[model samples]
Target chain A: MKLYALNMIQPVGEKPPPEALDKVMAELAEVRRDLESQEAWVFGRPLHGPEASTVVRLRDDEVIATDGPWTEGKEFIGGIIIIEVEDLDAALQVAARYTRVTGLPMEVRPFQGLI
Target chain B: MSVLVRVFGDVDVAEEAVQDAFAEAVRRWPADGAPPSPAGWIITTARNKAIDRLRREAAREGKQAQAVLVNVAEPVEEGVVRDERLRLMFTCCHPALALQARVALTLRLLGGLTTAEIARAFLVPEATMAQRLVRAKGKIRDAGIPYRVPEEADLPGRLTGVLAVIYLVFNQGYGGRDELAAEAIRLGRVLAELMADEPEVLGLLALMLLIESRKGARMRDGELILLADQDRALWDRGLVDEGQALVRRCLRRNRPGPYQIQAAINAVHGDAARAEETDWRQILQLYDQLMGVAPSPVAALNRAVAVAEVEGVEEALAVVDGLDLGHYYLFHAIRADLLRRLGRREAAAAAYDEAIGRTENEAELAFLRRRRVSVCG
Candidate 1:
């Protein structure tokens, strides 16, 4: 099953310990290794937040543009990846792997598709 | 305690003894040939076990109140189907417990479904289901979720939860690995018999019959038949008639709810002679009504499909385009079918892959793969 990995991250001033981050990477590696056998495809990685933005607006004949990381917030989203696995059960197992690394909590929702 | 009729006043005591007796039976029954009346013997032995426990408690706790328990005379009448199992179901569905726990416990205890089956019904894992069962039993013991039926006034409110349990039973039957589908059907028959006064009860039984009646035709040449393509001639007339009769009776009662409404919708389809002849207008109207009552995304999805049929494929695509059915296999599969029919082959191929990626059912995944091959090759 394809799943959206919701990496709910906290502020990085309190960044996760080296050991914890190592555990997270190790777990990701193990999951990738294990699920490759049972599933069709896997898509994911940590990101540098959603800094790549293009904002625009339309009028009767004119267009409006704005520069932005529009939403004002304290902690921006640190990362996420869309993964393809065997089922919800397998996706959840991957989520459990992330849960073991305690910098922040993780959530996995099965994805529908792109239009 | 006689050879039967050992009734324990408290569920804790009764269950403890029953577990003990079951363990003993497991040890002995294999070595010795099976007893003629194994259940009766177990009941009797369990009762004695409970008496022994009380005696021990009387000695330890130093308080003797022989007030609650009343040992009964022998029950030698060979085979009147006792309702202890039904009573077990009532206890499981007691309103004091949370709705989720009630459904879980009912499937586990009364339906005799495996934890895996119960989990699949709830779309969770066996481990998760096991934890839920443990927590449910703990709530029953600690929070004192009752071991009896609700009050006369509470019966109607509680009936909804019982109905939900029946629905769970049907789903397990509908997708079970063994004779669960048949067993679930039988459970519905018994439930209808037990709750005859309730129109929805009859309606649910009719629904089960109607849906199950088509199982024979749901697959053709080992491929699952879409409802639109299923051969009308293969549909079971007997089940359709029973369902129609129940819906008519239900309509006369004038009590409307989700199950009754859904059953009515099914009744319309059951009455149809061909795919083209299906009363989509009535089915669409029913879906609109159900959306108001249940308000689930699933109901909305079905409505979209109905709307698609009534209006056009583009309209249907617009209806479901923004829906968050990421994990829902049918959503992607149906979308792929719509796209493929609309001659969007590349998009259709991608959607098929998406559907294949998300689906766990081997049969469905295989079907999608074959479709992908035919469409993209």
Candidate 2:
């Protein structure tokens, strides 16, 4: 078995209307329930917007801190879910389901361990 | 190679073992008479070679290599090799890999062509092609792209990727490399046999055979010849017959797809003994059906050529002008032909110049240049 991280890519802009967001959240909850039933879900949660994020770095043996995302972009990682599956294909299948429910893109990457 | 890949589940190890087995054969086959079952003998020898290599690696790597070695030690039967080849085909043509990588890997692993040879055929540097093959194999291993046929639910979508890769290889061959075209046809035939019930597979094979049948008449003196001007007598009758038979089988299946429709159109053209005797109405109908099934700017441009024959040059030109195909040389070439036929010499000359500027082929450039001069006169 392998572990994969499905990072939800959210656009950095005004939020959708409440009615639309409510429907999406309901569908997402249903998807989460499905994943839990399959015993594939490990961890999942949404994060605050990128505006609330801070950057910390080390430069010349001195610690540094930044006020915004490491790199400014039109889209940010708004949420993440970790799942255990057999292979990339299975992870992709799960990611596809999440994307369908949330109407957002998901980047599926395998956790590095066995080369 | 396929059998060894199935056994070891590692492309690099499988490839090395197959080469080692062949080297062993070259050394011993001259001294001893050829074995009755040469294929079985090679499979056994390759399997043994892979086991030896894995054992050596396992000694250094410890547990991980030892676990893989245990899996590699299983014996593979010769009869299952055919299925293994099919599995290998699916893996090499997996949708996860880029199209160029898939084509290069297919030719290398299944076609048994050297990287240098594949490089020459695709017009890429040997080092670049070698790197591409290595990256593709690494991705397949790292991404855990399974070396097995997809389940029935995913077969249609996955099969489309495989067929597209084969067709792309055939088109690359059609450009100038006859050997690549031959290899594509051989792969198509193997696919057809393995998936005999698949109408689209048969359609693709027939489509290639029909186009290849006219290869003898496609060029003359290193210059391009239009299909209408080619000598019908030069066409291979045997290939035409075989291709037409496959088309008939597809027709009986009553399942229509883009490749099958294109093959049917070619079969229609093959029925004509002379170019003037060609049935424009039937060809146009097929194009309409093709557009319905798989609509694209290229297909629309091709459909315009048939419209010129059936409807008139004015109507065809109207359709061509509406298409957003400014970047395609064939779009300009077809527009030039239609304009010339309508006595619009100035417009025709400009369109011919567009085609001349767009195309890079020496033979095609020569033809376009000659046509451009004729328009001026």
Candidate 3:
């Protein structure tokens, strides 16, 4: 089995209207159920907005902290879903379902040394 | 190599094993008076070499090599070897890889071209091409891109990528490299044999063969030769016959795709004995069908060229001017030719400048410059 992290990318600001967001959430719930039925779901959760992030770096044995996201961009990673599947094609199928439901891009990356 | 890839599930390992087997053959074949089944002998030798390598790694590492070793014991079936090649083709041309990477990998893994040769063909530094191949292979291994043909449901979509890679290689060869063009035709034949019922595969093979038939006359003294000016006698009659036969076969199937339409158009061109005798009306109809099947500005531009022949330059120029293909060099070149035909010297010269500015090929630049000079005078 291979573990893939499907990172959902979304615009930085302005939430969708409640009605539209609710419909998407409902569709996503169904997708989650399908993944669970297939026994491929590992874990998944929405993240707080990028404003909630803090960056910490160590340079020459000295630690420094900075505020905001690591790099400012129009789009940011909004959530991540990790799934255990046989291969990339299977993981891509799962990601495709999520992207279709949400109408957003998903970057699928495999975890190293986890196959 | 494909069989070894199937056995080992690793491209690097398979490649190394095949090279080792060939090296052993070179050393022993002359002295031992050649084996009765040379191919089988090589496969057996490669398999043993792979097993030894895996065993050494298993001892050094811990578990991964041992897992691969377990599959090494399976007997190689003759029928499976053919399927293995198809599987390798699909894997090498997977859509997840970049387009250039897909072309390079197909040439390297399937065409048996060396990295240096591929690099030279592509005009990239050898190190750059080597890095590209290494990165692509790493992604395939790390991402667990399955080393198998896609499922039936995904076959059509996946097959397009494979065909596109083959066509890209063919076009690259069509520019100047005869060997690359031959390699692309060989790959096309292999694909046609494997997917015999697929009209698109047959169509692609026919397209390459038809184009390749005219290769001998495409250049003269390192200068580009327009099709209308090419000597028909220079075209290979055998390849023309073969390509036309395939197009006829496609017509019988009656499921016309973009490639089949393009091939049919070429077959029509091949029918004419002289340049003036070309069936422009038939070619225009094929281009119309091609546009309907797969519409693009490039196809629209090509159709306009045929329109120039069947109709007039004025009508063709109007069609060409309507399209938004500023970035494409051929669009400007064709427009310049139409303007030149209509006696619009200044405009023709300016359009030729646009074409010359956009193009990178030395022969194409020379042709455009010569055309521009004629219009100026």
Candidate 4:
């Protein structure tokens, strides 16, 4: 099975002014609805504003939590869905929808059963 | 040599025979006893299997030609095995193939990587990569791309494709998602070793070593670490030193290529005690030269980052503002950081969101999610 990460696009700030959120997610939800038939999608939840998100890492045997997304950037993942497509073209079709909906990008990956 | 010898010595058939021999060994070796020379036993078994297969195939055709050829088939030839493999590589790297297919074919054959492994590395589906491989191999067969080292006249033109194949393999490995990263490195190492006299090959290896040195430190568990966050103590000093030496050698040769220039940039990153100490000016110069040789928007964006360090955030933003890299995560990420530094928290956060949206990496997404929290706070 192919694995794709369908990243939800959102603008920066604690909240994407509810209007911006609605505009973007309307597009995303359309993509979400369209892609469900193409492949299997994992958990479906948009990212909370950065404040609500936590960065977690494992050090030695413990878990470390930090502010949020490690890189310094503005656009962040609002939510995610994983799809198992048959081929890269099919996967690209899924990613293309997100871009079509929001004029943004989503990375497509095929899951290797083993790392 | 009879046509029989050619078929028996063919790469695909030989590979199948060898696989069968190895499988038979695994079954019979335990039942009997380990041969005095296991490798020798396997080679012999495979050759004999090929001869038998040829005979059987001929027998099925009810032709004595097969029996005649088998009788004429000489004892196992030692050098032919390596020749076939080399022949395969030569065809796989033929200039006729697309850049992606070259690396895909190399990884599939030379590196012993499965289609699934290469697909994972490049972040594409397995079936697509598998088709790409098939198409590449078929192209080799259709165009009659020769299975020999390219002629000296063709070398200059084809060298770029060869180096590209090496770099492509390296990137697949470096891309972090695919297991082909190690395979890419192996391909690079082999290319370097094959062209040891050529300094650029060494530069490619050094460059890969330099960047790969920090691979472990780049990610802590599954979370990403910016250059500054990476612990210097965890860095591989051995790789750093070796890569530096190699880059120095390549620069001295004065016949620099993109790989050599890229190696120089990585060398600076590898040698810096801290991100602050990084020789951004030298990197910028290399990027300038790199852009001339291989112009890419990503390179320009990177150069913009260097400009930011030397000049200011506004200047850097302006450099990338009109560029066309809408779907790239790094461009958005860099823009977000620059805006954030300028205290345009709202805009910066928005850019960050754009970066996160572009990328599928969980660690990067998680990091972006948390950054939004801090920006609004």
Error of 3 at B58 (Å): 3.6
Residue B210 shift from truth in candidate 2, angstroms: 0.7
Question: Which residue pairs of candidate 2 clash?
Answer: none
What is the lDDT for A71 in model 2? Answer: 89
Better of 1 and 4 by lDDT: 4
Worst 10 residues of 4 chain B by lDDT: B1-10
lDDT of residue A49 for candidate 1: 51
Worst 10 residues of 1 chain A by lDDT: A106-115
Clashing pairs in 1: A1-A85, A111-B326, A112-B326, B173-B181
Cα error, residue B293 of model 3, in Å, equals 0.8
What are the per-model DockQ values? 0.01, 0.62, 0.90, 0.01
Model 4, position B245: C-alpha lDDT score: 91
Model 4 lDDT at residue B5:
21
Tell me each candidate's TM-score. 0.61, 0.95, 0.95, 0.67
lDDT-based ranking: 3, 2, 4, 1
How high is the DockQ of candidate 2?
Answer: 0.62
Residue B166 in model 4: lDDT: 71
Evaluate residue B3 in candidate 3 and report its C-alpha lDDT on the 0 to 100 scale.
Answer: 84
The residue-by-residue lDDT of candidate 4 on B83-192, one tens digit each, is 55445666677755787898888777778777897787777999999789878766554333456556575565566677678777777566564456666667677667
lDDT of each: 0.70, 0.89, 0.92, 0.72
Best by lDDT: 3
